[model samples]
Target chain A: MADQPTPFERFIQGILPENPVYRQLLGLCSTLAVTNGLKPALTMAGAVMFVLFSANVIISLIRNLLKPHLRIVVFTLTIAAFVTIVDRFLAAYMYQMSKALGPYIPLIIVNCIIICRCEVCASRQSVLTAAADAVGQSIGFGLALCSIAVVREILGTGMLAGFRVLPASWPSWTIMVLPPGAFLTFGLLLGLVNWIDAVRSRKKL
Target chain B: MEQQQPDRRMRLRSGFKNSNLAQAWLVLLLALVFGSALAAVQVNLGHVIEANKVNETLEKIPELVFGADAARKLKQRQVPIEITPGTIAVEKDGRKAYYKLFRVTRDGTPAGWVIKARGQGYADVIELLIGLDDRAQTITGIFVLEQKETPGLGNNIGTARWRSQFVAKSTDRPLVVVKGGAKRPDAIDAVTGATISSRSVTRIVNRTIEDLRGRLIPAKIEFSERHG
Candidate 1:
């Protein structure tokens, strides 16, 4: 444990051992809300990555000096700082996208993935480890988001990324874009992930 | 008991000095830096963001009205007026544009006054925007902006075939949507499946005119005198 970890170990740890969305299920709220469409899901993923990476590095650099009781508050303020920057940038450059995202962008501040990484990975580890951990979690989050969006877009609108994938004669299901669709799709996906993990664990045993 | 108490106090003080105080200072310092940075970015981008919003609105208005030139002409003289919670009247260049409350300006200015109208449609809430002749309050044109009726049926309020009904209608009498073609001088044909939408638009237009009569008449008189 004292020896510094290799780059491969850092990368593999994020995707497998500490997978933020799937294995840990840390940041499910935004994963569900913004994954209704491909474009929004991608944008959200990108924003989360930026905040996670930046906050993790900053937190790691100062971890030793941080008091234990106030650590959570410190992590929140750091994450919030990054989220605000992302939100303001989106509003200025991509006004329509920002409007469509609405409150979810600001809500990124409370995302457990960012806080969790700051606490578990950054608070005790080196800056490099923190950065790698943030990147890994971000990738896991992105994969989960896109996976949900792909299902919703295909079934709801008969389109993929706004382009029609189904035949012209196909009848589009309006229900897919509605609230019920989100809950159903997410639940099924969650179940599927759990089943896969269970099967994998059985094979290993 | 006395010995135990001293030991406990020593542990507590050590914990406080080593971890709690350091954590507090670190968090405080980070917060100060982040807050100031965020404030600086917001101040820098605030004007650009506002300008983008206005530009987006300006772009959408013309398309919604089906004529970019007409929308621009209207913008030149448009004065903002609020009618209800989510509705605004834009008076521009001798014409009026009425839009829903969602489009209202922050300062309570009408986006542009075209015309203000409401009527019973297929389901509920049929609002219309009719461009007016700034001087005569005569209907230059009209566009239906919103309706809650069935789609592919009642949503044709924005279609050309039904909207052509208002082309030469007098602003004098209230317009009506009839079963077939309008036999009267100011009637428009009701859509076959969308009778509700058609009727709603007609009602909205007529109701708007009724509502605007007092304001329109005085505004016209004032404009004519100023120009003349």
Candidate 2:
């Protein structure tokens, strides 16, 4: 248990124990904003994955050369560079999706999950290990976002991704698509995760 | 040993001498790289973005003027008017017939036009394409474009049933909206729920006609014969 985990273990930990949104709760603002629909959520998740993975590998490669005092500044600069690249790439190719996500895409620079991984996992670990950590964490983040989107989209519009999933008779809840819906959905999901963790712990005891 | 100690101190001082300046230089270099990259991207996409905006505006204008095929042959020609306010003028074969201008923006920008004899409907503002005969001050044909009132009650503005009433109405006299239906040559029926939207359309048409007779006819700007 004390030894470093294998690549597979690292990946699993990303979705559960080290979950960036639920377990770690490092970055939640963009998570809530983009989770209004499946498409926006998926796009944001992909952008975050790309930036996180690239930044981690680069940080690990230059860890030794980076002075301890200037480590935070270097890590931030690396993250910002990767975020800018992703932002521009999306704007050039997937212009519509970029417009839908708007300012949140660039705000990924301040996403603490990316910076945390750089400092804790990438800065000390090998490049391969850092890459594994990035992939694992990204998967976890994606799952969290998709789960929230599913509930919000279903109740808000009585549809799934734009396809009507609910019956015509069903009354649509307009509030689910608004700001309050984001808070309610996130709070409920957080509570459910905590409850499940507690029950599982009790069974073990 | 004492000489060696002084030499070591000199080396340590040299190592820390310009660290602040080096840090500042590093920051400046990174900023320059980022700034240039952003400028290049903006220059590349600027024209395409502008073209898309213009196309969107062109598409909306015609729909707001005349409904369907009537506006199909409509061509928009930008005319410079000295009124200092934005307005729309209708013409046929170089003679001005009908014109209307309204403030769509608070900053004095023209938002839309109301043409004479656009038709009467239940509710909502009905936009029209007004044209006149070369020698006559009266309007020839008024094509109804768009309206938003009540669906079943006010939507009659767009229907052929309510619109056909204006086919032969004389433009020499002002049009009026009546509760049951207009008995006069220049009157039309107003929908029950959408009386306000219907009245708004009638008022716009009347005002536009007045503007055409008072100002546009006397002005040097000539209205086009064909709608564009």
The best candidate by DockQ is 1
In the range B10-103, model 1's lDDT, one tens digit per residue, is: 8788885654455467667777888899889989999989888655534444333334454466557573322222344557567876544222
Compare the candidates by lDDT and give the number of the best one. Answer: 1
True contacts kept of each: 0.74, 0.00
Task: Output DockQ, candidate 2.
Answer: 0.11
| Location of the lowest summed lDDT over 10 successive residues in candidate 1 chain A | A170-179
For model 2, residues A1-205, the per-residue Cα lDDT tens digits are: 2486766777789988989999998789998888878888889899999999988998888766666666787778778877887777777667657756879999999999999999888888888888999999999999999999889888876887779999977776756766678889999999999999999999999
Candidate 1, superposed: residue stretches over 4 Å from native = A1-7, A201-205, B1-23, B64-210, B213-228
RMSD of every prediction: 8.1, 11.0
Q: Candidate 2 chain A: minimum summed lDDT over ten consecutive residues — where?
A: A1-10
lDDT for residue B61 in candidate 1, whole number 0-100: 40
Model 1 gets an lDDT of 0.71
